[model samples]
Target: MIVVQNLIDAISLGSVYALAALGIGLIFSIMRLINFAHGELIMVGGFVIYALAGNPMLVMALSAIIVVTILALGMERLAFRPLRKASPPTLLIASFAVSYFVQHVILMIFGSRPMGVDFLSVLGESFEFAGLRVPRLQCIAIVVTLALMVGLVVFFRASRIGVQMRAAAEDFTMARLLGVKADRVIAVAFALSGILASFVSLYLVAQTGTVSYKMGVNMVLIAFVASVIGGMGSLTGAALGGFIVGIVSVSLQAYLPEELRPYRDAFVFLLFIAFLLWRPQGLLVRRASERV
Candidate 1:
């Protein structure tokens, strides 16, 4: 039973990471650009929900989604569009600029102190069953992640836009040549990413019970690492990598000695290094051949 509870904890944590990683992977598939500012969208969504307190959960959630989606679209147009032809390094710097800019804006408005939101308090409730206890939030996290993942798979398989997205993922240049509107597709990708960020923020805020301006920094980092570990451009691999990261993270937290627990992140990186050395190309991405 102890082992079973641990497993549940790991999965619950992993599911959240997977959701964030999927959002990161979606944009990478189309644009080949890592939007470092992605977490800002999450933070923005959280703030929106925080500001609109006392509203129904459904209302706040929808508001967050709508506002973040608009911000994401604007980000693509203003920050990314002009740089479509620039070098990756240039785009990367731009992402950093956007991230810092958003962070400061939030700080200026919300101040340094974290704000509280209990809109989803029901999820914090826990129950015991089969000699084990679990929070309602944990179960919801797992279910939400599973449902979103399955829905994404189905969308990609059955929907027209989804097919275009997969095509872009496989070969953006060729797909564009075949008449895929690169800008439109990229915009759609960002919009989807924003929606995912909102969902991530919702779950994260519910679990942690507080929100701060820089709260998304760590999450975006984990999502980026998960993307790399899973394979740079493989959405499925990204999700897998998130699960790996989450399980390892929780396991370390659960079993590490009290003194060593503080350094668990360092230990997680060690495991990451070992995994990379074993499979540097990642779980699914093909290694590009060197050409003379």
Candidate 2:
């Protein structure tokens, strides 16, 4: 029973990380930019939820999604569009700059102290089925992640804009030459990323009951690690990497010797190093192609 519970916990945490990774991965797929500021999108969403604590859950959730989505589009247009032709290092720096700017803005407004949010308290409680206990949020997280994954798969396969996004990812210049609208595709990608970030923020706050300016820092870091481990530009790989990291992290916490537990992340990275040494291109390597 304990083992089962631990496994459920692992999946729940993995789902959260997977969502974060997917959000990062989607933008990377289109722009080849890591967008470290993606975390700020999550942070902003959390603050939105916190501010709307008096509102209905559905209303708060929708507002977060809308606000974050618009913010993401604004980020692309205002911060990144002008730098589109610049070097990758420049784009990377821009992402970091945006991240800091947003973090400080939130800090100035809300301070460094963590704000408590009592949203979704019922999900924190445990329930038993067939003599096994599980938190309601865990189950919901797993289901929601799976549904979103499936929905994305369908969207990519069946939607016109999705096809254009994939083409742009494969070769942005060529895709543009072939009549795909670069700005529109990139904007859509960022919007999707923001939506994902919103859900991640809500879930994180619900689980922790607190929101902080830097709350998204760890999540974005994990998302980056997952992207690298899964495959740099592959959304599926990013999600897979996130799950791997989440499961390993939880397993380490559960089974490591008490004294060594504090070093769990160190060990996780060591394993990541070993994995990279074995498969440097990642599990789902994107086809090597010249991007103009």
Candidate 2: Cα lDDT at 71: 94
Candidate 2 per-residue lDDT over residues 1-292, each given as its tens digit: 8888788889989998999999988888877788999999999999999999988998988999999999999999999999987877899999999999999999999999998998888999888997788889888889999999999999888999999888887878788889999889888999999989988988988889999999999999999888889998899999999898999999999999999999999998999999999999888988532232
Poorly placed runs, candidate 1 (over 4 Å): 286-292
Task: For candidate 1, list the clashing residue pairs, or say none.
Answer: none
Off by over 4 Å in 2: 288-292
lDDT of 1 by residue, 1-292 (tens): 9889989999998898998898888887777788899999989988998998899999988998899899989999999999988877888899899999989999999999999987698988888999999999999989989998999899889988888888888888777889888888888889989888888988878887788888889999999889889998889999999998998998999899999999999999898889888988788784321110
Candidate 1: what lDDT?
0.87
lDDT (C-alpha) at residue 82 in model 1:
92
lDDT of 1 at 265: 92
